[model samples]
Target: MRLLPVGTTLFVVLTLGACSPSAPEVPVGADGRTDPVLVQGRDLYQANCVQCHGSGGGGGRGPQLNGGTVAASYPDTAAQIELVTNGKGAMPAFGGRLEPAEIEAVVRYTREVLAENG
Candidate 1:
């Protein structure tokens, strides 16, 4: 049998791992149904946030929301909600435009879905 060098084997394993499928782009409920709140939040994010946060919250003009960045930045859910509602630095406040429920949904989406996928 042919044997791969240690470095080559490690590289192949790492490459395959990288190619593995990632978390679902959308969040689903325990019942296997899509979460309506997440759906609404995703729609709102696409409309309002994608321009800056980028698709899947990968980051662009705005700081990255994925990869646990949101969780790290705002360990407290309420703090994150407040930031979304009030805005900070270059981020514009959504409280004036979005309903309270919508704001909450979007925040949930970022923390639960985007954070995981990233």
Candidate 2:
């Protein structure tokens, strides 16, 4: 059996860890270009939502939105939109910081993209 040197094994492990995959990317448009709204949504989600909701919407400090949870919870998109616009309990409101359209984009991203993944 061949044994790797300690430093070499450590280097390999570190490299592999660095190469670990991130969450799946949002799908592209029929034109082969990424949807602008989804792109904006993803950026907003990473900046605002990732802290509480896991990158994949698997939930951390926040409730899980993945695996169709968001859809099930708020069958009416407007309800979710309202919740995001108006702060609820521990969840801080984004309405003051973000434009209504931007809020809508993020909501769409969560329901359509992140929710589908986990």
Backbone collision tally, model 2: 0
TM-score for model 2? Answer: 0.79
Q: Once model 1 is optimally superposed onto the true structure by TM-score, how far is the C-alpha of residue 34 displaced, in angstroms?
A: 1.3
The list of candidate 1 runs beyond 4 A from truth reads 1-24
Candidate 1, poorest ten consecutive residues by summed lDDT: 20-29
Q: For each candidate, what TM-score against the reference? A: 0.76, 0.79
- Give the Cα-based TM-score of candidate 1 against the true structure: 0.76
Q: How accurate is candidate 2 locally (lDDT)?
A: 0.87
Which digits, one per residue and each the tens of the lDDT, describe model 2 over residues 1-86?
A: 98999999999999999775344477987899888898899888988888898888888899987899999989999999999999
List CA RMSD, all candidates.
8.3, 4.3
- lDDT (Cα, tens digit) per residue for candidate 1, span 58-106: 8889999998999998999999889989999999899999999999989
Per-residue lDDT for 40 in model 2? Answer: 90
Considering every candidate listed, which one attains the maximal TM-score?
A: 2
